[model samples]
Target: MERVYIGMGSNLAAPAEQLREALKALGQLPHTRLSGVSSFYVSDSLLPGQPRYTNAVAALDTALEPLALLDALQAIENGQGRERLERWGPRTLDLDILLFGDRLIDEPRLKVPHYHMQARAFVLYPLAELAPGITLADGRALDGLLAACPFEGLERL
Candidate 1:
């Protein structure tokens, strides 16, 4: 099974509850098991005028390929009422594939190591909490990335 990291966030409805339910659904994915989850954190929206977000990172051991895993994650988001009404818009749930083991992927629909993870504290802080010292395919350490990420207003819950 490949170790995967998923970043989750929500700002609509009950954000923290949405993340809790998403974690349960992640553990139930076929051929996948939830291994670790970070403490929930609240952060201001990346875009101004939107609601604050509750975010966390999840580690999973899965046999599914990257695309299949992405599909499963999207299904979970849709089930939880995610809508793509606008780019960076508020949502009921947002699930992103932060990393897939040590593999690097750049596809039309997906990108591993999440194109912007290194720059966003909302992703890096909680991710560091769960997988400190983890290195990306490009050899950058997660802890180091967390250090360099611009501080956003993140509070653990």
Candidate 2:
């Protein structure tokens, strides 16, 4: 099984509940095991007019590869009533593939370790909560990234 991390967030329709359900749904995927999860967190909108979002991180052991895992995540988001209204727009559920083992992927459809994850407290804080001393393939520690991240809206739920 490959270790993977996913970032989940919801800013609409009972955000906390959506986040919880999303986690459950994510765990239901075939050949996957939900290994760990971070407590929910609340963060102010990153976009000018978006609502504040409730976020968390989840670690999973999965048999699927990076692309297949991304497909599963997209399906989970659709199951949760997510819509691509706009780039970085509000949604009922937003699932991001933060890391896929120690792999670094660069493709138009996906970017492993998540292109902007380290820069966002909403993603980093909860990720550190779940795996405090973990290091990515690039040798960056989760705790170190959290310490330097500048987004101040992160708060544990």
Candidate 3:
């Protein structure tokens, strides 16, 4: 099984509950096992005029390939009533593949070790909380990357 991380956020309708339900749904996917989950956190949205979001991260052990895992996450989001109307728009749930094993994959639709992972505090903080010891494909530790982050809008829920 490959170790992976998922960054989750929701800004509409009981975000904490949505996040928990999303995690449970993800865990129920075939060949995937939920390993760890971080505490929920509230963070100011990066997009202007968007509602504050509750974010968390989940660690999973999965046999699915990266693309397949991404599909599974999106399915979970859709199951939670997510409707994507705009970039970074408020939604019932947002699930992003933060890390996949120790592989770096860059494609038109996906980027493993997530292209923006290092720069987003909303993603990093909760991810580090769930899997502080994780080592990225580039060999940098999750905690090390988080130590250099300067974002200040996150607070535990």
Candidate 4:
């Protein structure tokens, strides 16, 4: 099974409950086992004037390929009322593949080691909690990335 990290966030419709439910769903993915989850955090929206988001990170051991895992995550988000009305817009749930077994992917539909993880504290902080020594394909340490992440305003819950 390949190790994978996912970032979860929600800003609409009982955000905390949404995260809890999402985590439950994640554990149910076929051929996958949810192995680690970080503490929930409350963070101001990346975009201004939106409700704060509850965020966390999850680690999984999965036999599914990256694209299949991405499809599963999207299905879970859609089931939870996620809508792509606007980029970075408010959502009921958002699930992003942060890393997939040290693989680097640059597909149009998906990117591993998620493009914005290094710059978003909401992603980095919880991810660090779950996998402190994780390294990028290029060999950058996750803890070091968290230290350099500029975005702040996270409060552990």
In candidate 1, position 64 carries an lDDT of 100
- By summed lDDT, the worst window of 10 consecutive residues in model 3 runs over 125-134
lDDT of 3: 0.87
Model 4: clashing residue pairs? none
* Model 2 worst lDDT window (10 residues): 148-157
Winning candidate number (TM-score): 1
Model 3 per-residue lDDT tens digits across residues 1-157:
9888888999999999999899889879999999999888898888888889999889999999888888888888888899989877899999888888888989777888887788888888888777768788888887888888865888887
Candidate 1 residue-wise lDDT, 1-157, digit = tens: 9999999999999999999999999999999999999999999998989999999999999999999999999999999999999888999999999999999899999988799888889899898888888899878898789778866588989
Q: Distance (Å) between predicted and true CA of 15, model 3?
A: 0.7
Better of 2 and 3 by lDDT: 2
> In model 4, what lDDT does residue 120 have?
88
The Cα RMSD of model 2 versus the native structure comes to 1.3
lDDT of each residue in 1-157, candidate 4, tens digit only = 9999999999999999999999999999999999999999999998899999999999999999999999999999999999999988999999999999979899999987798788889988898888878788767898789778854688999
Candidate 3 wrongly placed segments (more than 4 Å): none
Each candidate's lDDT (Cα)? Answer: 0.92, 0.88, 0.87, 0.91
> How many residue pairs clash per model?
0, 0, 0, 0
Worst 10 residues of 1 by lDDT: 143-152
> What lDDT score is found at residue 77 in candidate 1?
95
Regions more than 4 Å wrong, model 4:
none
Candidate 1: Cα lDDT at 153: 83
Q: Candidate 2 vs candidate 4: which has greater TM-score?
A: 4
